[model samples]
Target: MLNKKVLSCAFEKTINIEWHKGQFTTNNFLHILIHELGHIFYFYDWETFKINHIFYLKQFLGHKINNLNKFSELDKEKVLKIFANSNYGLSDDDELLAEGFAYWLLTKQSMQTKIWEFWNEYFTSYLPQIRDKERKEV
Candidate 1:
């Protein structure tokens, strides 16, 4: 029964990516940052530490191989899919963690963020395997 604000506080403790105003408006770009922040909080949650380590390793290597911006939608989806679908991905845990955090931000009046209309379309495609009941319930 953790409140969204409580989850947000827990999530912010680990990830420190500064929000870039310019990128904030972009669809997948924002989700990318949110997803990485999820990993930070996932590590905070103490579930799958070594696997999260490997997830980052694969992300680093994938970025190196693709030479794409880490924030790029394609690049980010690659990382999210790999992390959320691998042994770590099996739980659908990361998606819930990330979406929970993002959902909090979306709900807070001070956050000044709209529910970017296209996010669902884009994220749903990347999240083919994981289902987010909370998102629907919200």
Candidate 2:
């Protein structure tokens, strides 16, 4: 062991230093990975993906998004800008499905619990393929 203390951690493409303190967590990373795999599932199942997308799009656009995550304060203006500006999610059917899948996986929602149920069932049926795809993609 050296005299100097450990300064940072790196996991795959994500680097964590003092600057990124509290910005994310292990659960968040898994959620994001799950989100991307959700996109792949959407590609395989277009009809169900479309239905979920339209439903969530209406739900989110109809009201202000208040509790999307834990790290940020809620604000309609900022959230809308983020929805419009993000590279993925919030702007299209596929992205919406992916984000919704991740949200459901991460947070156990009681209301409209069907979304989580659907993914859970879907993943159960396709576990091996899902794990393989996620490993390759990330």
Candidate 3:
């Protein structure tokens, strides 16, 4: 049984990790947890995050454009390479961020590209500042 209020709160900065015994390996569990945390980070400053990463949003959306013939073959290849690490990221902007976050943390490697640089900075620097500011407000 799930509580509707709690479920609603989940969209409002609440993160609840439901653990199902033997359902996931340790690696999968950590990946999922980090991915969910990425969602919370995005929710913290939705507009700013979206604005700051518009290039990525556009590139991710390019996957769809490729199907419509609006994107060139080179651009499509670039988009494919960018999202090769996580196909799920091709789904949408939010999923792209979350999947990238999980991949970055799990691999413990810097992507060194412009979009990933922003993502890394968001999780490492911006998000902490936001949290600190909120703590002061409370």
Pick by lDDT: which candidate is best? 3
lDDT of 3 by residue, 9-77 (tens): 653332223222322222254577788887776666554433334343444445434363475756654
Error of 3 at 67 (Å): 24
**What are the TM-scores, per candidate, against the unseen true structure?**
0.27, 0.36, 0.43
Off by over 4 Å in 3: 1-27, 47-52, 56-77, 109-138
Off by over 4 Å in 1: 1-26, 47-91, 108-138
Give the clash count for each candidate: 1, 0, 0
lDDT of 3 at 45: 55
State each model's CA lDDT, in order: 0.44, 0.48, 0.55
Across 1-138, the per-residue lDDT of candidate 2 in tens digits comes to 522123212342353331155322232446656777978877764443233434333345334334554334334334433432123454566765676567556765555464455445444544445445555654
Ten-residue stretch with the least lDDT total in model 1: 18-27
lDDT of 3 at 127: 54
Q: Name the 10 consecutive residues with the lowest summed lDDT in model 2.
A: 2-11
TM-score between model 1 and native: 0.27
lDDT of 1 at 118: 26
